[model samples]
Target: MSESIDIVYEALGRYIDGLCGSTYIGTARGMVVLYRGAEIHHLTPLKEPLPFLNLFYRKGTVEIVGVWREEKSEAFFLRAAAADVRLFEDERTISIITYPRTGDMQERGMLIITLHANMGMAKTLKSIIQEETRFIKKEEVVISSRVSI
Candidate 1:
């Protein structure tokens, strides 16, 4: 795990704590902490060198998305539908989106986590796709910015 990943995990832990208010069980990996299982805090602890984005919620499910740079190209990771991942690079910043299961989305109690290096870019991306999909519906987006520690 890298220092960046540790920082991101700490931030995520704080966010999760605020929402669910439940004690979290996290798996430590070097400097990174990967959320272990279906547990909110254990769901996704990034490995390393990945920046924070934001969380989004649609209907009842939660989604976590983030963008990072690898080999000079933007890499996108979506913790949705088995983690939909992608990569991109250009004048615009990269974006990633994850949707929850259909049943969960319809429940309107899910939470979505979206992370990115740029807050403005993340927000714009979220607004653009907020209604374009139903993978995760009736949920809220938790937005977080990435910073070097």
Candidate 2:
């Protein structure tokens, strides 16, 4: 496998060593899993890169939601769902700022992992999103700085 592939897989799979799916039945699905939990996460891509993202706050963003559970089935990463994957920072957890294609927002429109899981879960989801985003997005450098004496 390519080094980048190894790098990404290793980084994401760091926590999977203790989780489920350690058995060897195969089932035709891939053996590697990054983070598996009760929550079902949705993933999307950014067509255009964001202008800037501060490093300290940008770590631990998840890109691919979950692993493919079956062989012939491909994990569908939604491109159009970009609009629904907005991030809203809360006191502890980052709420997935989702919206329907039409109509108004309702009680059934949002999702959160709770405060205790802010980093454990929310950060993983965010990290997956960020990593995949970085892999696909071209690097762009912005210059210009002001000097104050």
Q: lDDT values of the candidates? A: 0.35, 0.27
For every model shown, what is its TM-score relative to the native structure?
0.25, 0.25
Report lDDT (Cα) of residue 99, candidate 2: 31
Kindly list the per-residue Cα lDDT of model 2 for residues 1-149, writing each as its tens digit.
Answer: 64434433542353243133221111111111111134333221112221111111112222222222222222221111322345555555444443322222231233321221244445545554554453433221111111000
Which residue runs does candidate 1 get wrong by more than 4 Å?
1-38, 46-48, 51-99, 102-111, 130-149
TM-score of candidate 2 to 2 decimals: 0.25
Residue range 73-123, candidate 1, lDDT tens digits: 222222343223222323434434233333433332233332333445444
Question: For residue 106, what is the lDDT in candidate 2?
Answer: 32
Each candidate: how many clashes? 34, 11
Flag regions of model 2 displaced more than 4 Å.
Answer: 1-83, 102-116, 133-149
